[model samples]
Target: MARLLLLGAGHAHMTVMAHLPEIISRGHTVTAVGPLSRHYYSGMGPGMLGGTYTPEDISFPVQQMIESRGGEFILDKAVRVDAKSKKVLLQSGREIEYDVCSFNTGSSVPQSIVNANATDVYSVKPIENLLAGRKRIQSLADRGKISIGVVGGGPAALEVAGNAAACAREAGCKNVSVRLYAGKVFLRHLSPRVRSLCASAMRKHAIQIIEGSYASGVATKKVTLEDGREFDEDVIFIAMGVRPSALIAESGLPVGNDGGLAVNRFLQCDEHPDIFGGGDCIWFKDQPLDKVGVYAVRQNPVLYHNLIARMEGGELQPFDPGGEYLLIFNTGGGTGVLHKAGISFGGRLAFFIKDYIDRKFMREFQP
Candidate 1:
């Protein structure tokens, strides 16, 4: 039996955990490792700020699920990979040898804005950080008016701004204010109509929007822009997207210009077949996929099948990520927006659809 080591409890890896029985039935010993006890669905991240779901509602207990499936679960972070030795180094100063390994560690928040006066600045990552930021906002609301600043203008930032506004209102803070610094352009990834709709929603909630500039520095209570303009910000949330996880690049694996691990058609490391990867951490030029949840979700079945095949010495299957997929944004208050290709729509129905899909996905990992 081959020893299969699955790294990270990310969306893709969690799928593998759910199918541990299938892998074990083939005479393979599976071990899953990560730092978090539970895995949060990023789709419900906006729901977190909007008071629709708690951490428990959006996350699944990783360790419990793996253990129930009779697979080993280690709650430790992977810091290094010795491809030549076929071993993984953990943060606890231990190492594990494996016949095969798959990484779905997701991405890390970029620290370009980290500075000496970045006390009140927080990076939105690991999901737990967002929960902690929510608590901090709730607590600070009791003191006085709260100035919430969001950096980034993508779909994620839009959802965060809207949900945060709703959260502030639900917390009984009437003087809550939100400012979105959408570096350069706003919603450039969406169609013009969709962008207009999103901008309208933020404006309706009185979220101050700033365009054509990025945050140059952050202070304890202020954010300075590249144009030398500054604003008082009580709390700043960094949602400026993510970069590849450092473990992949540091492992001396082939990586893309973006630092994401270079993977081939079968999701195997371009340089090492025994080491495979998927999710936000991988970059496959032939099947270039966006660093989004939808691709990772779709890759689960393929990854699972290929891993089993690789162990059985069977032919590998190629992965092809087809054209555009739907993009939905929960705009708080049981309303949301949906966009795909050149089409766009918004309503409570959209939110319901997103909620149903998210719940269904989370249910698969539930005990």
Candidate 2:
């Protein structure tokens, strides 16, 4: 029997776990490793921070799903991949040998701009950090007025800033304020209309949007602009985009410019065919993909099929990124901005649509 080692309990890996019975029945032993037993759905993470959903509503019991399906689950972080020996090194000093391996390791926030002495600083990753930030905001607001600073110009930063304002409001703290350091232009990559809608939404929540400069450094309860101006904040959130897990590049494997595992159309490693990957952790050779959850969700079936085919000596299917995806930003106060195919709209109806879709997705994977 061949051994399959699955690294990280990400979106694509979750689908694999749902179909584990088929793989196990094929006489293949499966082993999954992750830093956390439960994987949080990043799509609804900002809503959870805004008190729109509970933690249990957006997280999946991945460890239970794997263990119940005759697969072994290890609650440990993967430190390295010894490709030559076909073994994975864990943070706990254990080595696992596998005939085949897959990575859904996900991405991480860049921390180079953060100072060592920074306090109350959080990253919009792992999804769980938002909960902690929400609690901190409530705590600080209980005493008096609190200033929260969010640094970044991307969609993640916008979501964080909007939800943070809602989090305080839900906690019954009216003295809370939010400032978004949106660099040169807010949502610069998006259409002008979408950017304007997002800015209006932020203004509706009394959030101050600061542009024309990016954050150069973050220190103790302070964010410094690139132009040498500093703003004091009770809490700070860094949402300056994400980078693929360093484990792939650190293991000396082939990587793209973004340091993600370089893979082909079949989602198989260019140099190591036995090594497959999806999600934000892989750099597609055919084209560059945005680091969005939609791509990860779309890769689920393709990865599941390819992994089984690789083991069974069957034909493998290539992955198609598909057309433009629908994006809905939940901008607090039961409001959202929906965009698809260059068409955009905003209102309560937009939020309702997003909420329905998000909840439906959770129900599909969460039993």
Candidate 3:
């Protein structure tokens, strides 16, 4: 029986966890190494920002799930991976020898945002911290005018700005403003019609959208843009992009230009054939796809196939992300945007659709 090691509890790793029993039944040993025992559903994070769900709704116990499937779960960060030697070393000083290794170490907040000294600014990648920001926001309730400035025009920024607006209204706050900043190219992955629909949705919800710009730096109750435009905001939400976590660099594995694990179409590193990576941690050699949870979710089946094939000495089939796929965004005022196949849909029904998709994704993968 071969021993297989899975790293990280990201979406793709969690998907493999569900099928772990089959691997064990076939006599292959299974073990998962992760820093946190809980995994977060990033797609549903916006819902939590809108106060539609709780922390429990978005988190799942990884350790319990792995054990239930007869796999050992190691709640420790993988510090180093010796692909040539087929061994991995954990932060807890444990060495794990494996026949095959798969990595799903997820991305983190972009360094551009994190390294900047932006007062009262927050990031969206670490949802747990955003939950704490909610409490700080609540404390400002009834204390006078408060405004939140959101940088980036992606779905996450839109979700944060929209949710903050809705939250301010819900908290009975008056004179609250939500401002969003976008680069020259906003929502470039989406079609023009869809972008226009989303913009209208934001405008209708009273979430101000400032396109073709960048926020230079932030101060308490103020934001200075690169173009000299200024905004008075009590808080700044940084929701632009994400970078692969530092654990990757620490692992001593080769990463791509995008700061993610370099992998081929089969999700295998060139120098480390046995070390496969998926989720946002991967930078596919051909075309670097957008960092979206939908892409990660779509990768589950292919990752499953490759992992199962490795156990049986079978060939792995590569999966390609299409040029365009469905893109959904919630505007935080109980409305959202759904763009698919060059069509756009929005409103309360769109929010319901978003909710259904998130709930279904979580339920199907429940450990």
The candidate that achieves the highest lDDT relative to the unseen native structure:
2
Alpha-carbon RMSD of each model = 1.3, 0.9, 2.3
Off by over 4 Å in 1: none
Candidate structures ordered by TM-score, highest first: 2, 1, 3
Give the alpha-carbon lDDT of every model. 0.85, 0.91, 0.79
Ranking by lDDT: 2, 1, 3
Put down candidate 2 lDDT per residue, 1-367, tens digits, no spaces: 7898999988978678899998999999999999998999998899988989899999999999899989999999999998988999999999999988999999999999999878899999979999899889888777767889999999999989999999888877868889999999899999999999999999999999999998999987899999999999989999999999999999999999899999999999978889999999999999999999899999999999998888888898999999999999989878999999878998899999999999998889874
Best by TM-score: 2
- N/CA/C clash count, model 3: 0
Q: After superposition, how far is residue 279 of candidate 3 from its true place, in Å?
A: 1.1
Error of model 2, residue 346, in angstroms: 1.0
- Per-residue CA lDDT of candidate 3, range 220-308, in tens? 66777788887787877788778886766776778888778888888877887777878888888878888888778778888888877
- Residue pairs of candidate 2 with colliding backbone atoms: none
Which portions of model 3 show Cα errors greater than 4 Å?
Answer: 113-119, 219-221, 249-252
- Winner by lDDT between candidate 3 and candidate 2: 2
> Where is model 1 poorest over a 10-residue stretch in terms of lDDT?
111-120
Residue 169 in candidate 3, Cα distance off native in Å: 1.9
What is the Cα-based TM-score of model 1? 0.97
lDDT string for model 1 (204-296, tens) is: 788988998988877777878999999998888888888889998898988987898898888888578898888999988686677789888
